[model samples]
Target: MARIAFIMLCHKDAPGVIAQARRLTASGDFVSIHFDGNSDPADFAEIWSALSDNPSVTFANRRYRCGWGEWSLVAATLEAVRAAVAAFPNASHFYMLSGDCLPVKTAEYAHDFLDSNDCDYIEHNDFFASDWIKTGLKEERLIYRYWFNERTQPKLYYASLAIQQKLMLTREVPSDLQVMIGSQWWCLRRQTIEKVLAFCDSRRDVMRFFATTWIPDETFFQTIVPHVVPRNELRNRTLTYLIFTDYGMPVTFYNDQYDLLLRQDYIFARKISAEALELRERLGALWADEGSIFRPRTRGRGFSAS
Candidate 1:
């Protein structure tokens, strides 16, 4: 049996978080959570209580005060990963998820799929890719320093952003390191995860450079993991579904979208709200009925060290 460690980063929606965790819990799967430090303890009391009795569930003692497009998000995720790795040393794989994320496939299917495939499932694109940089979004994110203060007033925040854009205080990222950006959510093999954590521990310079970069969570892992692991061992696809809106926020799934989610090839879907109880129940029923067999679209050789 393949053991899986789920490293989840959560801020709010206690019920949804618990529901997602409960769905993935199995004899060989462990759930490790890191609640945002900014969130009140009282707000997460329900979550703590729900998982406290479960031996397979663990919580990070030190949480990061996460903010959008800030390094804190990366910090919180790394904390969860480290905690999970420590608690479940025998786990074969580690899946990074958010509180709003729910498994589309059953736990048995996940394990079987991982058992059959050895590549790391992560989505990434080179930072200098024309599509990502055409609008200067990549340049602004990787070059210019962004000072993000979550508590800043809207007007002041815009004003500071405008000034930063005008000044364009660009910094040079290390020439040896290739910058990559992608979805933060991913499923990595245990060996890959261990190598990534080791690389981060030794590379303080790389860490400091990304500390002030916008959305470091999207770049940090993608940038470093490729360097540490063989390119062939990396499958440039994340097994999670995310739909972005014109407003830039992900569209939350509701009961009406249940059919759409089931049709997706992804193993998981995100932004499922607690209020979508009917959808949750329907998915749970499907999970109960599904067989343990997992059929991958394609199979490759097991991962090899670089």
Candidate 2:
């Protein structure tokens, strides 16, 4: 059975995605991809050639260019998910990710546990704004899509800090509306994925409504899952885990964290720059751990490496 499917989005992070997917496949998991509207076909071909295993790649339709809070980016992902469902009907869980996301551990450990839980990990209620991701107090802030300018705040380093500094200066978003912050990525159940897509397809009007909104991914998935599963059942956080500063600043875990990451506990991590040196070291670490930790765990049969 196709146990899990990773819905990965990449603009140019092909090399990183390739290394990550290979490890996942080695553990007997199937992988699927949707290169974003921006990746050139030739670049994609180079990516395809690098992968050791054969994985399905979907072409994402980019109806419009998206900025930090723009709904279009989320719209593109939804389209890809819709396509994945039509194509891989039998998969048990639908996992979402970015090309920049690298596994902290192996897929088997994460999938084995998730498959057993038979629960979804989406949050429904409005995320009360308290520097949501440290963006602001509540009043002046916009969904990251609005406030984050890739051109102006090109890297996450600048983007996250720039936004936070502004918040410290203002300390508020607005009193009018509620704002919630969450990872754009998630691990949704097949039923839930179908339900969310069905809601969007059934109510094209609602889809249109979200598209115009800022940072639609945060709202789109958060809104749809609540309709299918009770808000409480939706997990409030990603299960794979993370490392954050004492002040709750997220520090990118890299090859140095590779040993900990490949430990039998985690699924994935983010803000990984494929351009970084750690990719190779992390891949090497996974290769070393793969034999003992990843293999027997394939069918829920071995000791967890973490």
Candidate 3:
């Protein structure tokens, strides 16, 4: 009886999120949602009312105005996870995902697979050793301080970087941290999450350092994970399927990409187009189909149906 708690960070598309929450809870999984503070009040109210009847659904109390590459994103995720943890004590795994993400596999399949495995499925690699980040300030993101939101204050953001570069003003990675980077989405064991949160609460210096770093959402938990979870217990992979362009933007699935979506064996996919109504409906039906088990075509990874 392994249960999962899904923590979703959503900013838009209330209908999509509401549909997803109902579908997720249909199989007895717990869903905790955190709507962005900047989202439309009407949409937020709509989602809240839509899922109010579901006992397995919970909403985070502390919402933050989230922005790209800002610490607010991580703050919002923390709020969601805290709500999920409080509501679902029996949840063995905790999955952090976006509002646009939807599962391609049944809840039974996800539980069956995770119950049999001991390692966490999170994508992570040493920041300096990997070339996954193609553009922007890669390694410099760790050592530099970013006080302004890149999306909202582009001039201040770049100007700050320029001043820091010119003055050689650099910061240090917390001595206890290794500075790992990875995809923001991950599926972590409950124990791992507990340890991560505990460490965060106890270490004020580490939190303060990451708060000013570039895109702390991508590196904060990633770097803390290695120090908490042992090497053998970490899978170094993600269950969510996502493809990034050469420019580092995630590829969005649309109505015409049905075949492309089905060909992948991942349980969930990221960045679905908001307008893909038919695609979502079709995928929703497929996900709720429990007659068949999900089998991964590629054995290269450790994922399996059994």
Candidate 4:
């Protein structure tokens, strides 16, 4: 009963969403989700009912208008994390994710690997300190939600540029006021999460200040994690990166790329087709059918990600 929380933000991608839930449950791991409020309740309800019997499923009640770089995403995700943290305070770590993500390995393997390592797989550092987004134009950024109504969502992203090009029109930034940016997904230790929440509370002003910034989610999580982890704990590079062109984080494997993915050192790749004859698909499906996920790449590890 190693506790692992899955934070999924979903809207219209029903097939992918259901497939992912099925796979995770099959793996016998715990998962929690944050569905977009902008989505269809009926559709969500159907999916929820299908998954309701799974002891691992915990759904979030709050929703926000998530945009590319607004604080809404950070705020919403933090809220979800807070809920999961409180409910399963003793869980070892929280693994971040979106609903469309397809795992490259067995879920059980991934969970067991993390369970064994006991390391936080987040990449936070001063590495991107000088990036354009963090250079003192703090008032225009925000976070990106997993899904959105383009009209409302686009404007959230626009605020950043509007503030930059039309508002201040200055390119210069001061050293102390610099902002940071990086990947939004991570696997964080329980203690690390507390620190991030504390930082959010202390920097309510900072979080509030970036509510309208260009893309706060990328920077919000990126910046804060680096600050909280023990100096030696963070990897400086993310354990999680986009899988592929899957706007939902696609990891492209042509019918031919299967063998290569299995041989790679990475744990989660975007996804292989839910139905295919390729090794990964066959293996993933086989493993998935047996109730496994993110497991190691041994020939015996049952299934692959969707």
Q: Give the best candidate by TM-score.
A: 3
The C-alpha RMSD of each candidate to the native structure, in angstroms, is 5.9, 7.8, 3.9, 6.7
What's the TM for model 2? 0.70
What total of clashing residue pairs does each candidate reach? 0, 16, 0, 37
Mind giving the per-residue lDDT tens digits that candidate 3 earns over 142-185?
78898898888999999999999999998877776777888888
Question: What residue runs in model 2 are displaced by over 4 Å at the alpha carbon?
Answer: 48-66, 123-125, 129-133, 136-180, 240-250, 259-265, 275-280, 283-306
Query: Which of the two candidates, 1 or 3, achieves a greater TM-score against the reference?
Result: 3
Better of 1 and 2 by TM-score: 1
lDDT for each residue of candidate 1 in 1-306, tens digit (9 for 90 to 100): 778888889888787778767766743578999999888788589998988788788888788888887888888888888888888778888888887777677766777778898899987789876353334256767776666563555576567677877887578997888888778889999999999999889989888888978778888998888989889999987887776654455677898877677666677788786789888777765554456444434322122232
Model 4: worst 10 consecutive residues (lDDT sum): 140-149
Residue 50, candidate 4: Cα error in Å is 1.6
CA lDDT, every model vs. true structure: 0.78, 0.58, 0.83, 0.59
TM-score of decoy 3: 0.94
The sequence of per-residue lDDT tens digits that candidate 2 reaches over residues 255-288 is 4655544442446666554555766555535532
Candidate 2 Cα RMSD after full superposition onto the native fold (Å): 7.8
Give lDDT tens digits, candidate 4, residues 110-146.
6666767755665454434444233433332332212
Instruction: State residue 103's C-alpha deviation in candidate 3, in Å.
Output: 1.2
Best candidate, lDDT-wise?
A: 3
